[model samples]
Target: MTETDTLRERVAVELTRARERTLTLADAVDDHDLVRQHSPLMSPLVWDVAHVGNQEELWLVRDVGRREPVRADIDTMYDAFQHPRADRPALPLLDPTEARAYIRTVRDKALDVLGAEPLAGRRLTTDGFVFGLIVQHEQQHDETMLATHQLRTGPAVLDAPPPPAPDVPVDDRAEVVVPAGAFTMGTSVEPWALDNERPGHTVDLPAYAIDAVPVTNRRYAEFVADGGYDEPRWWTADGWAHRREAGLTMPMHWHGDGTATRFGRRTDLPPDEPVLHVCWYEAAAFAAWAGRRLPTEAEWEKAARWDPATGRSRRYPWGDDDPTARHANLGQRHLRPARVGAYPLGVSPLGVHQLVGDVWEWTATEFTGYPGFTVFPYREYSEVFFDRGYRVLRGGSFGTDPVACRGTFRNWDWPVRRQIFAGFRTARDVA
Candidate 1:
């Protein structure tokens, strides 16, 4: 096959994989739940369902293909920046049946464009970046919809077998020291890397120790038991206020009796599973209580991608390869994070485990563009969100699809957001 044929095949496969996931999550819930706003922090599931199609219609069908509008009337209704989540349920949204049909039509047209359009000549068409963007966008919504399921109060509508046990015995409390050095950070040539992740740059840093695996329920529970939340000394001024205001004493789904809610069912918290649904403040407080700190974005990336032996950075912790089931617990294959010691092969050269998936590890860095960052496609995608109010969360969560998760891939949210599938590992500077 020619290079163009190969590229088209890869893009087609990814787009299909992402769409399948989107439909599965949307179909899992009944129409009532799909339309219901599970939390103010999230859009109605039905809205997300329709929005992904609208995005594909706009970017792929209309923009890239130069085709006429599919559903121009409802475009404003689905504009995320135009309407907040809290106001969406009250809007005239497409019913479940209509939403599904709408996406089907959009996808049909999009695939036609995929087959006919030349994969070059236009900036968006170059290397199938627009298709990649749409795939990642849809997968991101799938993850968001999964989070909505976690927030919804009802019988579980989703189920998956638990993630496999550790391939090899793992020490739950181990830490790996990333020696002081400079390493290339971010992506210079990753085809689908967003504007914010562009322009790879060298970042020099001092030695620091990072947790080999994410912080687990067992360890975080110690923080709760020792009054970590009550101690202001362990929290920033803003974090202390938010903690008290929100009554956050433990992880979002956790109950005092060592149980946590998962997909609407109450189950005993698996002690070894990486803690999930934590805000940046909670992660920071826990780190302080444990006499460590959250790793900076640079520190976290270096630990995950910098290979001391080669003096180079890799696309992922394991290497420059797409993730598979054996590498990390990604793509919603399992609804929750795997055990702390799982995915021995996913470990980085520096010994950091589960850096690409499980939970988004909160970092000390604020959301900002890297050095020489340039906006491409659009500014709203990432450039507009460079405000300091948002904290950076490196690593992907179990719900994240591999197409959307890479070492340079970055996710960010307000520090007070606990609805996201987030957790953290602590780090300490070497003396």
Candidate 2:
């Protein structure tokens, strides 16, 4: 294929992949489940299904395609900012069958837009950036829908094969010591990179050591055994208060027994699996108890991407190649985090394994924009969340799709949020 043909085909493939994945999640439930809001935190699944189509039409058909709105009447209903998620279930949303048809119609028009734009020109078509953005956006909502699945009541509606049992045992003492250096952080030329990761800047980080693998179930269980929750010395006053009020003695979805609950059900906690569904506050407390600290966002990035020998960074911990099952547990291929140290092939330049997939690894930094950050397409997508209250979470979870995750891609949430798929590793500054 020619370069132009290659780009066009690439965009088509990504768009198809994204739509298919969205449909997979949307189809898993019956019509009743689709229209019902599973949680106050999430929009109804039907809303997400139609909203995905509406967003594509707004961007591709109206903005890029220069065509009329697909359904102007439903615009306000789908406008996320205009109507909060809690109120969406009450809105006059398209029913499941109608939503299905509506989304497909918009998609057909979006495909037409894709054909007209060679995707090499400037603006939204530049490098097929808008299509890339839409794919990522849909994938993100799918992840959110996955979160809603977790919060919903009843038997597990979604199921996936479990990742392979741990073949590679992690050395508890394994910590990669990164030498102090200035590393290029974030991306500048990555075509689909969001504005938050733009304008690559140099971050001078001091020598520090980060764990080779994420904190394991057995490790976090030990913290719970040590009264990590009851002890105030180990927690910030706010975290301590929150933990007590919420009565969180262990990681969310974890029980006093060996059971580790996930997605509306409970299962035995594999002692070796990377701990999942932990909040930032809980992670920080555990780090305090361990006499270590969570890695700063810069430190985490450096550990995951910096190559001191080359004085540069790689696109992913395992390098520029796109992710695969052997590389990491991504794209909802597995329902749970693989055992820590399992994906040796996904290790970083300094040998940090599981940096890109599994539970999102929390960092010490707040979610803020990089230098020269500019809002694109819409401000609500990212800018609204870049506040002091939200902490940054690096890496992606098993539920995260390739379209929604990259080394530079950033995810954030309130520190108290535990219903989300998140985990963390500890770091210690070199003395």
Candidate 3:
């Protein structure tokens, strides 16, 4: 197929997938829940629904088409940065029906712009980047809405089939050595890569050995059982303060005796599931308890991208291809992480599993600009949070859609955050 045809097909697939997922997530609950603020941290579902379309219209139609906004009056109502999530419910947001109609109307115009548009010769559309960006933006909001669903206290409003059972038991001792060298640490050519992930640079990382898979609940439980929470040495000053203030004994949504714990309203899971909902502090403390440190961002990316045989970087841990169901547990296809070591097909060249999905893996790096980072479209998307005591998270979560999850896609949250889908694997200097 022609390259432009390929781009058009991709645009169509991504747009449809993003919209459908958003609709499905919003439809899972009743109309009242859709417009209600389930949690103070998240915008109302109805707000997210309309904001998704508003963003698409702003970028795809207005920016690409060079046309004035069709609904300029409602722009402020949907501007996320203008209103905190807690106060968004007070705005005059469109109802679910109106939201659906608004998104459909915007989408109809966007599809028309997609065909007549050239693939390049512009800043944002340098290889249809804006289209990809819009798709990613819509999918990211869908993920946020999914978080709201999880926080909503009710019987399960969403359901999905469990991931395929692992063919082998997980080995907690599995760590792979990524050889010492200068490896490409970020994306240079990924058309849809965000501004923070741009301008790939060579990182001279010393040799390190990292966990082949993420740290699992079975292992984290051992730390908790050993007075890991009560002890202060393993935690930082800030972490210890937050720990005591919040009275956190275990990962959020967890409750049990030392023998077993359950997540939210789910059934009791086996010990092999990757630990989730733990903040950076908890993950770091657990790593310290195990006599390991969390991988630096450079080390994590090297393990995920380097191919020792060819001495080149792959777009993803497995290869330079778009993800598929056979490769990773992503796109809300499953509501929870698969058992560790399940998606062997998604393994990196160095044999790292669960690097792309199942959960967002925390890294021991602060959120900051790259060497040549410059504002694009606006600064609110990533730059504002660069200094708000946020740390980096790699990989995507099961709640993340494929359009939003890429090898270089970066997620950040405060170290004290626990409601989000976050997890981690540990690394150590090569001995």
**Can you give the TM-score per candidate against the true fold?**
0.98, 0.97, 0.96
> Model 2: per-residue lDDT, tens digit, 16-59?
88888889888888888889988787899999999989989888
Model 2: residues with Cα > 4 Å off, grouped in runs: none
Global lDDT scores for all candidate models: 0.92, 0.87, 0.86
Candidate 1 Cα RMSD after full superposition onto the native fold (Å):
1.0
After superposition, candidate 1 runs with Cα above 4 Å error: none
Record all residue pairs in model 1 with backbone atoms less than 3 Å apart, i.e. clashing.
none
Clashes of each: 0, 0, 0
Tens-digit lDDT track for model 1 on 206-322?
Answer: 989999889998999899999998899999999999999998888898888988899988988888899999999999999999999999999999999999999999999999988
Error of 1 at 89 (Å): 0.8
Error of 1 at 61 (Å): 0.9
- How high is the lDDT of residue 303 in model 2? 85
lDDT by residue for model 3 (50-89), tens: 9989998899889898777878888998988889998998
The C-alpha stretches of model 3 lying farther than 4 A from their native spots are 257-264
Find the number of clashing residue pairs for candidate 3. Answer: 0
TM-score, structure 2 vs. true: 0.97
